[model samples]
Target: MHLHCYSWTGAGDDLRREGERRPPLPPGDLAAFRASPLPPMRTCDWLLKPATRIDTSPPTVTEAQTWLADRYGTAEPSFLHPADEARIGLDLRLKIAEESLAGGTDVLWGIWLKAGGFICLVVVCCSPNRHADYPCPCRLTSP
Candidate 1:
């Protein structure tokens, strides 16, 4: 399947492919995050703000894993079915909430996966500006 990325700032949608330039991240203060014992984390801004909201009814682990596989054509054996909300940092959650309130994104739709000794987020994102949905996969590491 052909994959694409989009810039969705509530403005016109600009579509691009994997080798092309990436879309700009919505307004957010990732630097505002205070120091912590965890190693430095890395991820694009779009991952924090999913274009679509997650379902109210939690998906089973198997369902989440299947979704991951279907979207990416592969799924990690350690993929966590439902997200471990408690694993996310409080400060980060606050930042995401603030950004969402500012209309930066709809919500965070994510699942957890264990990579080696670290835990990461495998999230889904799309272009809010266009009718077409381009699902993108991103990883977010947490303390």
Candidate 2:
């Protein structure tokens, strides 16, 4: 698998400046991320935000299906099934509310996987107010 690392200041101006001034991160830098506990500091202002992209090796459609089925216990994961979309949306709303109550921004992570003509998108949001819990994979789960 290959991973890409980048950061966003959560502002439009910073994003535009980043596109104009910064080059892509070195592949070795991403490798270092997996081996080291602390990531290197960003040299530019726009590259200091929190975000990342992970790209896995291409897999066959059947492989993707099997992986999802194993991870979620169903061929159709909740994120992929239309019937569960509303529930996901509501969960995000509640998460945002909880974050607001805790004096933190509503931090959300989006995962997009594509391989062998199959695509899956997952959005996991963390609420700053919540304590550590196994079922919640948000970064703020721990104090």
Candidate 3:
């Protein structure tokens, strides 16, 4: 969906050429946030808002282990999946840690192996399968 508000028209867009700095954030939280090691966060301008969402169902720990090992070389037993709404994709960090292939890929792909070693590419997630959360126990539980 696209918004065709007056902002997209010539008049409002021209204001971009004369963009003004936004007022600084309120002091109460500003100092505390700035003191943190995390990257600075900022609000988006109304001129160009992002699409509502870019979601992928969280991958299973088993899948993450392979991708992480194939990339990070040390995903250890499994990833401690973050608990958050955005859940920023950590695949890029995995890439940085991996020894690159002879031919770099825009996207890394892989297959899932069955117990007998029969395998299939994970083209899409099939439901109602779901990954278990951390501290979930050493045993496997079918979703």
Candidate 4:
């Protein structure tokens, strides 16, 4: 499974002005970046070099929410919200709950803002499962 998140800093109007100053991303690398299966945060130079050149700080949940709200607006519903629990498919919720109890990995990636109006992209490659079940998909065993 994979998830993607994006965020920024400063007023919306400043983005266009700031963007003009930065070098553009290579046309070819966009696909590769998307295809890569959650590369480690430390390896985010590809993104940091161009789009988020100003900020080098790590991403935070608060900034992530702010970015989401800014771009998508608060009107649209979110499955992660507790009030929308009913909207979450029963099977998926069950799987998540079971996974929590049994232990499973979580991977995250995103871009976040810094103190000086710069943004940084961060990728949390993987959070290992504390108590995985037998026949774990993340690991291989000799027969």
Report the number of the highest-TM-score candidate: 2
Off by over 4 Å in 1: 1-89, 97-102, 105-115, 127-143
- Residues 95-137 of candidate 4 have per-residue lDDT tens digits of 5433432332332222222332333232211222222222221
Error of 2 at 24 (Å): 21
Per-residue lDDT tens digits for candidate 1, residues 21-45, read 2232453343333122221122233
Q: Under the 3 Å rule for N, CA and C atoms, how many clashes does model 2 have?
A: 0
**Candidate 3 lDDT over residue span 1-143, tens digit each:** 01111111112222233223221334232333322222111122211111121112224433433544443232212223323211534455444323222122112222212221211111121221122111211121321
Estimated TM-score for each candidate = 0.21, 0.22, 0.16, 0.21
* Higher-scoring candidate on lDDT, 1 or 3: 1
Instruction: Give the per-residue lDDT digits (tens) of candidate 2, residues 26-111.
Output: 42232233322222223221122233332221133233323323433332342334455445554464445344423422223222
Worst 10 residues of 4 by lDDT: 124-133
Q: Better model by TM-score, 2 or 3? A: 2
Which lDDT values do the candidates have, in the order given?
A: 0.31, 0.28, 0.24, 0.31
